[model samples]
Target: MCQRGIKVTHVSKGSSSTKIQRFIPLANGLTDNMKSFAVFLLVLRYLSVSHGCTCMEGPQQFPAVQIDAGQGNVVMTDGNNYAYFLLGSQWYKMGSLNLKHVSVGPAGIWGVDLNNRVYKYVAGSFVFANGESLQQVDAGGDGQVVGVTDTSTIHCLKSTIASDYRKQSTLSWTTITGGLMYFSCSSKYGCWGVNSLQNIYFTRVTPSTCGISGWIQVDGLAVMVEIGTDGSVFVVTRGGEVFQRQGIDSSTPQGTSWTKIPMPSRISHVSYDRGNLWVVTDYGTILKCLY
Candidate 1:
């Protein structure tokens, strides 16, 4: 027996879980032969592994301007100099630091204050992470942090503390060559950034360096880009549309194409993890897309 075309089945609302199944047919364009059988099997396997995922709305809303998610936590700044962290579906006010941007990773959380000073969250308080002022900061699950200055100069935080040492020391900041307006990194996928021109760039993590390559222009204008711990990529366009990459693997370093995820019309920021996607609207509504 042979199927004829691709068919997708999706469940209606009110279900606890949404299940999607994709089927491919071989009868329409192929002759009745063994070759068609083999092709059909391969197509079935591919479709099963790569079905499109969708987003689900979250419970709470906030006046957030920036958001980040890590293994066990999510954090965001409320644009009024206050920050909040989500704990098991409930959001709690962390403090009033007047931060411009914030990020969370496996090691901890990092943020830049209104004056461009970078700080690390330790033991429920913000501690100065580096001396030099930065315009923005981002972190990775492996304790890697990177920042950019007002002049677009790039800097990375290098830990002087030993792995076995219990006491921690302030991280040393070093400047890199490239200039960027926004920067993000994934412990597994290296780093990515957008320059002043809104052009996107990617770098692979290597033993010696963060192998930064040249910038590649993508379709549509992106205001922000975020990478998940597993290398999943998401971007929010200036027009308030959210787009995600077709795959989460690091093999596609340049990310040639994207599929627009159906979301609110005024999304301003986005973050991703292994299980869910989070976004903030221009009016400060926080929503999550669960797969």
Candidate 2:
């Protein structure tokens, strides 16, 4: 999903005054003229790398394989498939069940294990959601959840499935037409997905009954796609390029064009929520980006 040979340069945001003061103490063991030149070079190097968006290393960057964020909640899995949930500034390990892919949204925190078993976070543990099996499941949809099986079949949670965790109700899913290798949903503008052919498509999904309209093909090829809660769409192509949907609103759901978002290194997985863009790089680095 990513290439090599590019060294990652970490860029962080700071006050202009603080940046100048940071170099004040580095003038030791140098002539007055040499100190000034060294500081100038450092500042210039910093400015050249800090462009587009500022990104810092995430709290826990232990080779994140998959990450999802929604409603101020962030959940991810390490290379070992151990689940974790971010609380405040610390990441607390969630349950003992190993999960390959996890998601968080209005419906709840749900995941699909290596065995393709579906589980939902209830109370403080993951509980089996009926006997459903899927390769990846997304809970970001409005009042429901959608998932794609290993065979690329799409299914959505039944409307009867309550979002409340305390209910602990037996969840069921209804199959949706169309095959998708990767899919993401938003409460506002429905869902967006990418098929095995790398074709991008969109559909209006009824949150009430998990009903979906016909697929509307977009003019692009993407390996994966993610829909932000605020109706924003972001996609990563097969070449590890990231782009955001431009001019998207209530009227133009498909948007007009794509605006590339600069990244220091190649990224495999990306999740956007609020104003933060979380990405796992090719070399197993998780960066929290602010635009």
Candidate 3:
């Protein structure tokens, strides 16, 4: 079990984009940044007792918490790091075994709210893309496991499993963020997203003539909001706007353009994997973005 302070209250929350960076209040005291939690992309952070991740050792093992996975759905990673629980009320640890969404993360997190309790994890914990885990195979005999499945979010356990990926995703991807659409500059890819309704699409820099032109708007949904980087796309009204984030992926390894792609699966959700994008459509069809 984890440490729990009785009678703890007051969970502080704020927008990191437009104000002074602040640490969230824990059940007992002020949770210092880089002290008790890991912040990536400044979008979301999981609750843990220790702050600052161990790069050389990577993410660690817990003492086993309560998960509760369910029926068929899917989970995945950006092939990088991911967070599982929001960690409020109390912070606990598991026993070495992670309740990963799929086998890994970077794809994105999900939630199962049977009683209306929303949570977060990745896409692969519950299912994977049908491809075997490259991390596990490369690890030789470390006993690492991964998989692929539809991204329907049939359960709540997927997010918990993918949370551990953060340990290994350290070397690559300057930062990781939970998002519907993403682009990268280091890789020279433009963007990865679905429409306002969840349609999916992938596009990139055409410079003179790399063949692909104007951010491609594939079909999709769940592409709620997006900001661009320089030479990137706009976020508002399809006019003069850009999706840029400072202090987070500032080097801009993310998408700059903001065009909603189409989703073959009407009910499908989106996830990012090392700039390699993946999504599940309404028809239970899985899609990937090829640069």
Candidate 4:
């Protein structure tokens, strides 16, 4: 048997009244072991609540056909072939460029031209980074760029310039693999990709082999996957459903169980940074997702 005491204080008219004390007895079925387990679970719940990720909905009237966030900046490409970047809350036009996909990260802004060549935005102009052409490109912090070729081969830019954003001559391309349709990377949590069959794969970024390895299968199907700086993962399905999971960890590298996020419209693209989640609907409506 166990008894726990709790004190309740009451006040009347801003004056202290009486202090009531109560003792609650534990249930007969609860043994000392059960009590200890319950206490452990309570501690875990409190920790998760205090340190877990949070999300909220943001502006609904953002002007862009597609949007991405990284490196304390939000970038969007409008329908007019114009690229706009957001510093703080204001949008600045970065001029016109023929880019089908654009991504911003600590490495700066990267775009893929109609011819599939990769270009890095520098000094108000897009400079060619590498000769290898790709169909899609995603930039990550620490000057990492990953892309998929027209033949579905995955390629990553091997940088010789280190952190220098100006020198494009120091960039070269290396093929990671083939048969991947989409890819995204987080400097903190490596990179993730989805193949033509909607299969997911992950490669850890480390000093060994530039973090490229044979594709490891992970559960879930996604048309797009975006990773936050904190390693939070968000995925958009072909059926327009948005789901999220924590990043790779010792217990669950494939991530925690997926949770469906409610949205007002069908999501066509998704991007996450820190705790903020952004989605663009099929109708070109942009919204910040709150969880």
Cα lDDT computed for each candidate against the true fold: 0.65, 0.80, 0.26, 0.65
Best by TM-score: 2
Q: Which ten residues in a row have the lowest lDDT in candidate 2?
A: 1-10
Put down candidate 4 lDDT per residue, 1-291, tens digits, no spaces: 001121222336533211111111442467655554333323222221112332223343333467788865677776565667766656677766777788888667888877887788888888877667888888764466778987788777654342465757646566675578888887775678888888877776442234564566778998878776666777889999787775457455567567676554567888877556777766554555433
lDDT of 3 by residue, 1-291 (tens): 112211212245644433324433322353443332232212222212122211011122121111111111123222122223313322222122233322222223332222222222333332222212211100000111111112311111122333444332311111112222222221223434333344444443232222233344442233322212222221222321212222223354333333333222232233332322333332222333322
User: TM-score, each model?
Assistant: 0.74, 0.81, 0.23, 0.73
User: After aligning candidate 1 to the native by TM-score, how far in Å is the CA of 101 from where it should be?
Assistant: 1.3
- TM-score of the candidate numbered 3? 0.23
Candidate 2 Cα misplacement greater than 4 A, ranges:
1-52, 162-170
Which segments of candidate 1 are over 4 A away from where they belong? 1-54, 159-171, 206-220, 247-250
Per-residue C-alpha lDDT of model 2 across residues 1-291, encoded as one tens digit per residue: 121222335566665557678767777878865674455445434432244466666766366788898887899988889899998767799988999999999988999999999888888889877656899999888868899998999998854474753444556678899999989999888799999999999998898888888899988899999998988888988888888888778887888888777666677889989988888766555678776
Comparing 2 and 4 on TM-score, the stronger one: 2
Specify the poorest-scoring 10-residue window by lDDT in model 3: 135-144
Q: Which candidate should be chosen as best, given lDDT against the real structure?
A: 2
Clash-forming residue pairs, model 2: none
Better of 2 and 4 by lDDT: 2
